[model samples]
Target: MNPTEFLDGGTVTVSDETYTVYKTEHPESAAFATIQDENETTVVAEAGTVSGENVIESEPGWKRLTFEMVLPFELVGFLAAVATALADEDISIFAISAYSTDHVLVKEEDVPVATKKLEALGCAVER
Candidate 1:
């Protein structure tokens, strides 16, 4: 496989738990969904603190992974390649795919090693 370029780099740590969908305005729409744990669920009116600037609810118990990539967009097995690269370093990832690109969230503990692995794979690491 040819090595790819990553303009921006980010890594977030999440837990082993599953995330359930919360309030979705369109109800049946929105390519990306917001989720939280059952017990940790609650609604908030303030928008500035959370992403998308909407009143939303979530469980902070989990972690967040954020990546910034310039998009003309290429789906070209990016996730699988990243997964394999992370796996080679014994790091696990819980990934989410958005319209523009992919986000891979791993344990914060594994971040340094993951960075090294990604760098080794010949992708730019934005530290």
Candidate 2:
């Protein structure tokens, strides 16, 4: 997994069962332009969500990126490692996942350090 960190997302949550999200034309979300309104939900970041409905709100000044690698059921440690790496650097990350891979978001400036930290933990990432 040649890890490439693309930090550029914002944190957001939904109050309803359905909402729309806008993507920045990133190659990652090329498969789906919008995640249809569904019952399942979790913390979402605005960085990937170009636009959305259901009264979406979030913390300002944050960034997001998809992990450089693909881990199926190994997300537990993947997340732990990410958290550990960021915790040590005093950085915060908000993460989400799709059926194929996971997405993590940190501050815009913290991208460099977060990238290095995750790389040290055996996760492939790019600067």
Candidate 3:
């Protein structure tokens, strides 16, 4: 199947809350998404929620664009297509994949352009 075909009839919704990506020594229970590995704990949460000593690094002002569709486990290249679309426009993204769908976090300043890029790829964007 074509990579962009997955976008057909799908919607990309922009979240109102700005988020921050934090690399912390310990897991944050309140984080929107947290990944723990032998190296470190990466936490994504609303800006200012996770901070202080445990946090080794923090990058704030990210806006989440949620692909509001259930992507089948067998689907291929969906995220690659989306990332490529945004990259073509020089927008960087932090991606997260859930059991049902995927989300990409772009710098807050790039939301407008990113929205347009996603829309151009056949996904309706909800700002």
Best by the lDDT measure = 3
Per-residue CA lDDT of model 3 for 45-116, tens digit only, reads: 999887588889999999999999888888899999999989999999999999999999999999999998
**Candidate 2 Cα errors over 4 Å, as ranges:** 1-56, 74-76, 122-124
lDDT tens digits by residue: candidate 2, 10-118: 1222121222233322222322223443442233433334334432443445555565444656335656656776899999876667676666667677777876666
lDDT of 2 at 37: 39
Q: Which candidate leads in TM-score?
A: 3
Ranking by lDDT: 3, 1, 2
Model 2 accuracy (lDDT, Cα): 0.49
Please give the distance, in angstroms, between residue 10's alpha carbon in candidate 3 and its true position after superposition. 0.8
Candidate 1 residue-wise lDDT, 1-127, digit = tens: 2225442243333323433333433222332343345544332212223444432434322223444553345446667777887898888776766676556666656767876776676555554
Instruction: TM-score each candidate.
Output: 0.50, 0.53, 0.96
Candidate 1 positional error at 54, Å: 18
Lowest-sum lDDT 10-residue window in model 2: 10-19
Write down the lDDT of every candidate, Cα atoms only: 0.50, 0.49, 0.91
TM-score, model 2 to reference = 0.53
lDDT of 3 at 99: 98
